[model samples]
Target: MKIWGEIMGKADDVMDICLLAGQIMLTYGAETYRVEETLERMAKSASFSNIHCFATTTGIFLSFEEKKEKEDLMQMVRVDDRLQDLGKVTDVNQVSRQFVAGDITIEEAHEKLTAIAKAPMQYPLWLIHIAAGIAGGGFSYLFGGGWFDLIPAFIAAVVSSIVVVEFERHLKVRFAAEFTAAFAGGTTAILLVLIGIGSNLDQIIIGSLMPLVPGVPLTNAVRDLMSGDLLAGVSRGAEALLTSLSIASGIALTISVFL
Candidate 1:
């Protein structure tokens, strides 16, 4: 009876650990199917043959069927905060793979995941600023902006990235922060055009706007729909739509004011 108790306790602990790992992946912008697959894999690692998991954009559900007890171990976790951190997603995948391969115990897996969750930025702030500027300029050139327009576009994008990064430090809502950043980009482009810094206002503005695009959300939404997760897909699609509209409105409002 004591050995049986220990077995049940260990099972419970593994379940909780798996749930926490899934939660971290979901909250950090992993796809629904990926989260479910990872949870299933983790359960298999613990010798469970009957594990079912359902993950959406905002929540996760997991259950393990116990053959002897004729009962199911169930857990539901609510996820509120969502962010796009590809690094975290990749790290979680590695940790899950390690756990399944018997490379680490459940407690060790939990500690590794926690550390990944708390990991700092991989790149410095100034490097991000430089990359943003280069991306803006390169995209503008690709979109047919002439040589003269590159400098203006670069400057606008750098300034936009800085403003958005600063706003993010204080703003909890992503939409608000994106809108403010887009508006700053628009305002900068218009000012540059007025001062004869660039001849093509449209090119410069478009380039600067590239940074605020919701690429990951849209891609994930499409993938979710393809995987038959209609509700999660629709929810993510709506978020992407709102972000696009916010960006457009920022530019339109700025142009309207100048006219």
Candidate 2:
């Protein structure tokens, strides 16, 4: 009876680890197919059979049977508040592969996964802001803006990025944050051009807005569609579309008021 108990306990542990792994991946914007594949691989490595996994934009479901006891275990995890943090997804994938390859035990894998979930952002906030500015400046030049437009674009983008981050932190609503950021970017571009700091208002505003685009979500939506996960694809595509509309509405409002 004690040995049987130990086996059951081990099975439960394996299930918990698998759920945690799937949760981390999904919460950090991993594709549904990748999350399901990782769950299956982890469960199989634990000597489970009849494994099944289903993942969506907001949840994950997994079931497997323990070979030792011939019993089934199932788990469902609700994932909310997704963000584009491919670094975390990559870390979880590395841990999953190591566990499957026997380089790490289930407990070790769980520990690593937990650590990753708790890890801070890879780049500091100030550094990210600076990078956003550089991207805006570069995009402005690429889009035919002269050197005089670069500094204004850079400043506008940096301010927009900061406003988005601050608003999102407080409001927890991305749509509102994005809208405010767009408005702020437009206003900044206009002010800079009026002050003789920028040569082209259009280029400055366009470059500033680039930082707020939902590029990752749109790309992931397309990838999911191509992979035949129709439900997830549609859900993500809709989300991307809504975000794009938010950006466009914000910019339009700004243009109407200022220009």
Candidate 3:
């Protein structure tokens, strides 16, 4: 009975670790297939023969076969928080591989994941704002905006970034934040043109829109579809579509009012 109890406890611990790892990957914008693969790898690493995992955009389900028990263990985890943090995803993948290689124990892997989850931004806040401005400026120039147009595009991008960040912090909704950013970008571009600081209003607006594009989600959606996760693919595609519409709607509203 004592040995049986120990085995059961270890089984439970392994389940928790696998579930938590899956949760982290799903929450950090990993594709459904990648999440499932990671879970399978973790279970295989622990020498479990019967393991099944199903992951969607919003949740994950896991089942493990018990060694000495009659009933199988099952767990479902909900994933709500999502951000475009590919760095964290890469970090998690490395950790997962290391765990599978037997370089770390389950407890150590859990600790590393917890630290990664709580990790701070690699770049400072100001640096991100600067990068956004530079990207906007570069795109504006590439889109045929004259050298003078870069200045206004840069200013517009910085303003849009600030508005989006502030709104997202307060509202916790991606749509609201994106819409607000687009409106601010459009309005700023218009103001720059009115003040004679910008040479081309169209170029400025187009350039500023670069920062608001949902490139990652759109790409991930296509990848998911190719990998045979139809549900997650459709859901993610819809999300990307809605985000694009929100941006367009905001820009259109601003243009109607000002231009």
Indicate which candidate wins on TM-score: 2
- After superposing candidate 1, which stretches have Cα over 4 Å from the reference? none
Predicted structure 3, TM vs. truth: 0.95
Pairs that collide, model 3: none
> In candidate 3, what are the lDDT values of residues 149-240, reduced to their tens digit?
99999999988888888898899998889999999999999999998998888889988888888888888899999999999999999989
Model 2, residue pairs in steric clash: none
Off by over 4 Å in 3: none
What tens-digit string does per-residue lDDT give for candidate 2 at 42-136? 99998899999999999999999988678888889898887778999999999999999999987798899889989999999999889999999
Q: What is the number of backbone collisions in each predicted candidate, taken in the order shown? A: 0, 0, 0
The 10 consecutive residues of candidate 2 with the worst lDDT sum are 66-75
- Residue 111 alpha-carbon offset, candidate 1, angstroms: 1.3
lDDT of each: 0.87, 0.89, 0.87
Candidate achieving higher lDDT, 1 or 2: 2
Of models 2 and 3, which has the larger lDDT? 2
State the displacement of the C-alpha of residue 2, model 3, in Å, after optimal TM-score superposition.
Answer: 2.5
Model 3, position 38, has a per-residue lDDT of: 91
